[model samples]
Target: MSKNKIITVQNVTVTISSEELDDYICITDIAGVKSDQSRSADIIRNWLRNRSTLEYLSVWEQLYNPKFKVFESEHFKKQAGLLTFTPSVSEWIEQTGAVGLYVKRGRFGGTYAHKDIAFEFASAISPTFKLYLIKEFQRLKEEENSKERLEWTAKRFLSKNNYLIQTDAVKNYLIPKSNYKDNLEWLAYAKEADILNVALFGFTAKAWRDANPEMAGKSNVRDFATVNELTVLSNLETHNAQMIREGRDKKERFTILKDIAEYQLDILNEAEKIKIEEKEETEETV
Candidate 1:
């Protein structure tokens, strides 16, 4: 990856920008890896000069898309080796009704093609580079997974903190007293636990407990949450507690926690936005 970790593949950034796709394909680095280039334009031009390259692109388009235009393709065939050759990924795409090559510009711009076309483009660039890109891409995925796991774990820890709060309350107010044997102390302990539960889970553990009271003593709310949800709740509780200690207003804490939860959930839900964008790009170029 370059300092900016941005590569110009076929004159576009290695990353695909969502704004560019509309009746055109964008090419992306197959691996989301980036590199600096000394005259990337020259590298692209050389690929265009290779007749086999054109045929490969043509075949890719034909196999994946039925509406590809042969008329423009024929023109490229005639002009392939001439000194005046000026075909570009974009030009080829436009002329041949391609759905696979995207010519994009600006920040986060890239020639992001579908993975199929992107791999072909990468192979054309440098087989070794393509291999490196794939390796790096796999590494990126692993890193992402690791980050998500760590986040989830952190969330579970936060949830446990809530349980700890309830336990501490029990020790302080419910235990070591004659009331330990009284239903009143038990009710008070349950009430405070319910508050922490509602704060973290948007409902009381007792609500869950009441709904399935049979499972109450054996399991708690956090234990049942999907890792992603637990992580978000944990984050929320930690932040909310900080706000409380800091004397921040309750209104501000609620809003901020809501934003945090929603943002994380969005990332979880749309983890494949980049991949999906690339896939759509390939379809256009094809």
Candidate 2:
């Protein structure tokens, strides 16, 4: 998942900043859902002043955050639930070196917390709300994973068909004209196939195998191609077949096919970025 993955929990639109380490939920959005958007900061401070809240935060930081300032966390705990003990998200982060909470500024400004911390905060607001939040968040992740699988499968099918077409071209053109014995003519077909493979992947089949012996044993280089690479490869395969039928030599075809692969990959990659960015923008408004 991308960093900007958002999931709507009940009436709350929680943005999940999915990073390699952990997913952070927008605490401000969760606060807004429980009370009001304008009062989110005040609500957060109110929660922070509670003794239980500070204890929970301290335990969490101790467990998950190596750099957390346990001494300062103890100091904060000492003053918890006082008449003027309210703390902001920024204070928590600055004082305790807490990574569990974050306060972002600007148009989309808000406090965000790691999923574990956010869910705890939600429980303070309402237990039922936290349960619903968990459900929707799980559903959102499953849906995103499914969408990725579908796209990959679609690209795989197209590239597989393109590979088939290239094989037909090899049989029709290279096999008939080879000077090698009938059984040995298969080598010529393989050589011709590698021309397109090299043009798109930058490695001949044997070179790729030597470089990635374990992976190559189970899957070819094409199996691990990105969507953009696969899209360009499908097109390259079809074009290489046409060039082969025209009796182009490997040297000339490789030059032309390589250029096509580079150009199409660039175009397709840029288009894909634009498509994803537009979708993110639309989701923000909704």
Q: What's the lDDT for all of these models? A: 0.57, 0.76
lDDT by residue (1-286, candidate 2, tens digit) is 3267677777678788875346788888888876789998999999998889889988988876777899988888889878878788888899889888887777556888888888999998889989999999889879988997798688678665655556555423321122222123233445765766766766567756765666667866676566678778778877876775455666677778888988998898799899999999999999
Which residue pairs collide in model 2, if any?
A: none
Per-model TM-score on C-alpha atoms: 0.40, 0.54
RMSD for all candidates, in order, please. Answer: 20.6, 19.5
lDDT of 1 by residue, 194-263 (tens): 4344444455565566655555788766665544566566576666656654545444554566567768
Superposed model 2: Cα runs more than 4 Å off: 151-286
Candidate 1 at residue 66, lDDT?
Answer: 66
lDDT of 1: 0.57
Total clashing pairs for each candidate:
23, 0
- Residue 98 error, candidate 2, Å: 0.9
